[model samples]
Target: MKDDIVLSVVLYSYLDRPIFDVMLNGSGIGGANSYGGNGMITGIRVPFGKQALTWRLDGPPGMARNGETVAMKNPINLAAEQIPADAHYLAVNIYPDNTVEFVFDKYIPDRTPRGDQIIDKSERHGE
Candidate 1:
């Protein structure tokens, strides 16, 4: 497992609809909840190399109610040289325009640049 890296992912959205599915390397890890602008966080073990992260959202141009959804994928290179020594977390913010921002951090961030919508998964679910 030496070639594997543990990744903590925080997924959220500023779109009208929440991202219901978040995937890494095309595999589902979790999703971003829209309720109160809250987000969902999950951790996964992936290889230490080039990776692809994708998410599914429902709204505009597309219609969730009509069984239509929009999905976006972004490349995430997990090479050792790319990750900082102290930053071990990955946080993603999905925007209304089907864009996303990826951030690396040493600790899980309290909230995204927007506001107090994100809470630890454990704290949110009382686990």
Candidate 2:
């Protein structure tokens, strides 16, 4: 559907953070963690013109370190021109400092022609 927005999630952090659930509007969509260095989630469908995009982050089940489970709730405002006109995909990047970066991309395929053709050249005459 043209009104559907494709979303993805990425995690970037130096600390070995516990895996956390990614909730959209109070429902779990996927999980992300920094333990594996970097993680990515592709192909999340979000209907356009939604009231709000809420993210509910919670530590994994039964794996809370120090008896403290990480829990955070935030909302992404869609009415603030968060998305660009040329953007067709959205990415949410989370950092250890709880900083979130929303990236808008066109998701265009890399079509730069590869250097595969061999060129023939003669040896330098003055060599």
Candidate 3:
């Protein structure tokens, strides 16, 4: 599986609705490649290179409602070594109380401007 250049991510939603979409692209250790989908994606291409990967998220409008809760799970398959040592990951959480939480794999500086968060290292899980 080491030589596999494709990464597949499948997201399942307990609510049976589209919760969010993800886009990933990067250049470096695996190469330059991009993959994007809203739900249940498969066979995303990843090129070989030695750089960091970036991701973006898109969620449904008015997704947050008071006392409403939803569950989403994304299972990603990729080689662990393909990721950069210092690269971080981003995780977004939508709570039942209409609150949003942004979690990063690495600590974010207090003064870091909005829209400029860096991804270095971290993983996120939702309850």
Most TM-score-accurate candidate: 1
Clashing pairs in 2: none
TM-score per candidate, chains pooled: 0.61, 0.46, 0.24
Question: Where does model 2 exceed 4 Å of error?
Answer: 1-15, 35-75, 108-127
Tens-digit lDDT track for model 3 on 1-127? 3543443333211121233322334321111111111232334455344222222232456645422322223424445474544434333333223232333333221212221221111112221
Clashing pairs in 1: none
The segments of candidate 1 whose C-alpha lies over 4 angstroms from its true place after superposition are: 1-4, 35-42, 59-69, 73-78, 110-127
Q: Model 3, 85: alpha-carbon shift in Å? A: 19
Question: Hey, what RMSD does candidate 3 come out at?
Answer: 14.3
Worst 10 residues of 3 by lDDT: 28-37
lDDT (CA) per prediction: 0.58, 0.43, 0.30
Number of clashes found in candidate 1: 0
Give one digit per residue, the lDDT tens place, for model 1 in 6-78: 7776665655455666666665666555522334345666678766666655445655453335555445566
- What's the CA error at residue 75 for candidate 1, in Å? 4.5
Worst 10 residues of 1 by lDDT: 114-123
